[model samples]
Target: MSTQTPPPVATGAGLAPLVELRGIEVVYDAAILGVADISLTVAPGEIVALLGANGAGKSTTLKATSGLLVADRALVSRGSVLFRGEDITGVAPNLLATRGIVHVLEGRHVFGHLTVEENLRTGTFLRRLGRRETERDLDEIYGYFPRLRTKRKTPAGLTSGGEQQMLAIGRALLTRPELVLLDEPSMGLAPIIVEEIFEIIAGLNRTKGTTFLVAEQNIAVSLRHAHRGYVLDGGKVVLTATAADLRERDDLHEIYLGLASV
Candidate 1:
């Protein structure tokens, strides 16, 4: 890890930003660099996307903020991850989870042997709600994913790709997280299903005031769903703009498609 200190927090406009990262550097090995010099913020009720190509450090960004994936093997060598103005630098994964920083990982690691209902129940591990409240949360999750209700007794692995992704997200919702980090919800799914997943993500942020930081490679599709986007390249933020602005940039689309940025 580098010995450099992190940058100071930017001014909060009115209310506190849901999450903030300042000058954070994640080094995978002593030599393998991950994210570098990233300073970004997510406000309450916003859906933001970390857009990037393969190996551009998108997943690493989510993992660092969510406090999952070993930072020990990698070091958050620089910067601070703040949640509600509190420095969450190097906080434990379980602690972050309990504090409502839930991560729906890159792979929808659904419990293979567990029933769909059981899988959902696992999300409530960090929560202190009573049985009644837990049931209420379950109902809310089911409302978000009505399909899960039908397959509540079935093994999660037996579900369709889209359904399993929904289940992963639904289960995370059960935690009542203040911030959610979703990695590649569209992975390996049909285009139509990807659209459906993005709709749900937008709906949750719009209706429930949930804050989201999604990492996705599907730039055009994700831009439609996100309010703002940051493009990552070589472990650094190369561009940032509102979704509309990015859509307007012909050069941006060209770079995204690996064509000449005319």
Candidate 2:
């Protein structure tokens, strides 16, 4: 892993950060280290990518932020996670969701047996929306994911991989989140589907002003849509740069492959 400190990358510099992780260290089962001293920030209305290969701690970082670590028998053993300057480290995931932080975990998890629309309705449960309000929100979600509209009555497990990914995101959005922690959204999808998914994500960021912290191994797509990024390696942040700067780095491939230092 690179020992050099990543240069500070400005994101929404004039505004307060929406999410901040300070020297975060994660451990599993008390002894195994997941990630170490990882610090990063996502400013309001910005799309930030957490880029790294599998096992590079991208997911660990996201889990730590969303407080999903406890479910996996992991914990942020050091450092703090803050939201709008409030210390929320180790808070329960459900409480985090109510506070406008929603995580769409990797693997396109959905209620396999539930109808697509049924699965989507679960997102509104946390908000306790009235019937009419629920229908209106569902309509809005369907507008963003027209494919889901077409498959509203179809079982989620029967949908294509790309569709499942879309459903997962749509469900998270129904929570009306301010910061979305998206993990490996492009995984197992075709190139065209991946592009479509990213396009929608970008559109949401543009139109709805929803901030995103995306964890991805697909550097090309992630950087194409994100404003800034932090690259991780061996459970540590190795580089931080604007998306354009990272795209121009000749050694980015080497850095990802552990063949070069930042």
Candidate 3:
């Protein structure tokens, strides 16, 4: 009755992807490629940035794994989605949450009418266990984002953009997800707030071995936190490199700066 990886993943650091994608594709309603055959992995203790421009297939890749888009409307089209070495092509999105993969969408989707505690409780949809365990995860999430500690009694709508983003993440973490698909965690925040959010993301990966596949338009911001990253160009993975290698490249600067064509 445990959804914890079926046979369960190796309970140690540096473990392989709680979830893996191989040659993943997503075709549009008009048969255009939203994401044309991209392969990536999210191993324990790693944070990978999925980066691109406005129309790049970064969001599509995240959607595919989360199983939000499936069949004719938005199909995998080809290849496999492996979670703990098991193929999970076209799995239900809700079912995925139980299986230890959580997706926090681009817009902070906290329940605006609800208190911070209520928003956090929503993550417990998968785990139908004791209240003590729920409280433990709740406290653990707060430990990561101490700003949320003070505002736990406030309604989510009253929170600022950055705090709302933290709420979105804290809610996801409350599920105790092994891998999380985070879409633009730094979007629409002040520069300082953005820095703080990314710092917490980096710390989570370091301390708890939380795996992340993050989609972000802010290339520099994502690069600084990611261990490795993929650059999606026109629905295809045109570049895959370590974050350090990416930062070292004048080619990257030229392309992103409109100084040259990639």
Evaluate model 2: give its TM-score: 0.95
- The TM-score ranking, best first, is 2, 1, 3
* Global lDDT of model 1: 0.82
Per-residue accuracy of model 3 over 114-213 as CA lDDT, tens digit each: 9988898888767874889888888888888888889999999999999999999999987778888999888899878987888888777767878888
Colliding pairs, model 1: none
Best by TM-score: 2
- Among all windows of 10 consecutive residues in model 1, the one with the lowest summed lDDT is 1-10
Q: Over the full model, what C-alpha lDDT does candidate 3 score relative to the true structure?
A: 0.81
Q: For residue 121, what is the lDDT in candidate 1?
A: 95
Root-mean-square deviation (CA) per prediction: 7.8, 5.3, 7.0
Among these predictions, the greatest lDDT belongs to: 2
Range of the 10 consecutive residues with the lowest summed lDDT in candidate 2: 1-10
**For model 2, what is the C-alpha lDDT against the true structure?**
0.91
Off by over 4 Å in 1: 1-14, 253-262
Give the per-residue lDDT digits (tens) of candidate 1, residues 1-262. 2222222121222466889989889887667778877888887777788987888788888888988747457768888999988999888888999888999988898997999999999998777678998898899889888999999999999999999999999988888898999999999999888887877887777677788889998876777777777877767777887777776776764555446432
Ranking by lDDT: 2, 1, 3
